[model samples]
Target: MAVEFASPPGNAHEIALTGFQNLARFTQRSHREGEYGMQALPETDVTLSAPRPVHHLGLLQIVAHESIRNSAATGWQYLVLTEDGAVASSELSIGTDERPPVLEQVNMGPFVQSTASALEGLDDIPDVQSGRYELHTLKIPALGAFLLWLRQLDGNADLFIVLSPAPNFLQAGRIYREDELLDALEGPARKRLEFDDSPRGRTEK
Candidate 1:
C-alpha cells in the first residue's frame, strides 16, 4: 500500500492515498486451530468479490474494513474506488486557459489538522481545530441528484466529486451511497453509476 498526492491551486488540503486491500483467493490460506492465517500471494492479482473467491483473507478483510470506513466519510472530496478495488483519496480541479492541469494546492507537511480553514462554501476540508464539528441538521441544499455532493461557491464556482459509469448499464436518479460501488464491481450496477453521461437516466418520479 502506498500514498500518492496531487496539489492544485485555490483549494486547501486534499489527499491522494492508496493502501492495501484484503483481496486474496481462498487457496492461499493457512489453517491452524480454528483460525486461519493468510498465505503469501505469489502475484497481486487477488480477487475479493465473488464469481471468484479471495486468495488472501487478510487483504480482503482490510478491503471490507475500508469499505466500512469509506461508507462513513460524511465529507471529503475525491473518494476514489480503484479499478483493482482499493479505496483512495482524490481531488477535482479546473485550470485557466493557459495553465496545464491545476489541482488544489495544500501543505506537503505531516500532521495536518482535520479542521483546516474552509472558504465559506468553497473549501470543504477544515483546518484542524480543537474540536470536531458535525452538522446535526441542515437544508438539503439541492434535493436534485448529482454525480457527487455539490458545494456551491458563493454563486461563482462549484466543487463536486466526479466519478461516473458508462451509459449502456444506466438507470434512475439516486441519493447515491458508497456501497453501491460494490454492485459496479461484481453485479449489474445502477444507472446512477453514470449520472454524468445520463443526467436524467434516473429522475425523481
Candidate 2:
C-alpha cells in the first residue's frame, strides 16, 4: 500500500512518524492543545530532506495554504524533503499583500502536470510509510520568500493563508476551462493588481 503525506494548505506537516527516516531537517512538535485541542505553531517546519537529493526540485511549493494553516500549525509537522533537501520559505505562504510573488516565481516544476495528475499524487492508500511514516518529496523554489511574507504579514480581522498557484498554462489549457484558471489567478492577481493602486504591509527591513 502506498500512503501519501500531503502538506496542508499554508500549514506545516511534521515527519516524526515511523518509516520517515530520510528526513534531514525536520521541525519538532509540542504536544500542546489548540486546534482540535492540539495545534503546532505556524512556524514549525517538517523538512523531509533540507535539500531534496534525487529530485533537483526546489522548496516544495505547496498547492494549498489553508491546509498548511490547519494541519501544520496545530500538530507535529511532516514533510518529505526533496532529493537534494533544499526547501525555501517562499514555497509556503502567498506572500504578504506587499510584493506578492508571480506564479512562476513561487511554483516548482517543469515536471509538467495537469491539475489531475498533480493532484493524483495525493491518494490515501493503506499503511505505506515504508513501515513507518509515509513521505513524499515536494519542490518549491520560492519557499523562502513565502516564509518571509508570512513573518512580515499582520493586521487583519483574520489574515488568511490562501495557496494560489499561477496558471499552469499547459495544464489549464488541457484540464480546466479557461475561466477556472482565470478565477484561480483572480484573487492573487487582483491583490497584485492593487500593487499599483494602493499600499499596505511591511517592507523587508
Candidate 3:
C-alpha cells in the first residue's frame, strides 16, 4: 500500500507533531520475521495492511537486514508522501548485524550522513550540495519530524526523505518533484504497515 501523507490542517510544526504522535500508536514487533520485518526476518503478508504487496522485496530485504547493524530496533516504516498528501514511493530500512553504526546504511553514501546530520536536531537543517543534487533540510525543532529534500540540477526527479527522531526512527523517502521541499513543511503524515507477533505474517494498512 502507498503511504498516506495527509495531515490535519496546520503549520509545519503542527503537522510534524501530529505525525510523531501517530507514530507512537504503531504496534511493536519483537520477532525478526514479524510485521514489516520486525521478526526473525521481515516478511510481507498479503492479508495484512498496505494496499498492495511489496514489489521490491530484494531491495527491502537488504535494507531490513542492514538496519540491525545500527541497533535500530525502533522503526516507523511508511510510504514517502508528497506535500499534497500522496504516496511518492515505498521505502525500507532493514536490520543489519554490521556496524560501529551508520544512518540509512541500507543506501549508504554522502546523502545518508548529510541528511541525518541535518535532522539530528543539533542546529537548523542545513542545505547541502552533493554532486548534482542540492539538498535542503527542513526541520520543525519543536516537533520530531524533519524533511530532507534533494533537488537535481537536471530537472529530474528530486529526492525527499522525511524523518522522525529515533527509538522509533520512522522515515519515508522517494524520488519525485510533485511537491516542493517548502510545501511539505506545511504538513506531513504518511500511512505505514502494521504487523502482528508472527514474523512470517504481517498486515499492512
List where candidate 1 sits over 4 angstroms from the true fold: 1-68, 71-146, 149-167, 170-172, 188-205
Using lDDT as the measure, what is the rank order of every candidate, best first? Answer: 3, 2, 1
Enumerate clash totals for all models, in the order shown. 27, 61, 35
Best by TM-score: 3
What's the TM-score of every candidate structure?
0.19, 0.20, 0.22
Lowest summed lDDT window (length 10), candidate 3? 46-55
Better of 1 and 2 by lDDT: 2
Which model, 2 or 3, shows the larger lDDT? 3
lDDT of each: 0.24, 0.26, 0.30
User: Model 3's lDDT to the true fold?
Assistant: 0.30
- Candidate 3 C-alpha lDDT tens digits along 119-147: 33322223223235443333333234445
Error of 1 at 146 (Å): 9.7
lDDT of 1 by residue, 1-205 (tens): 1111223233222222211122222323433233454433222532221010001111222234334222212222332233543222232233335343223321111111111111122233331122232211011111221233322222312222212221333222222233452333222222223333534536321
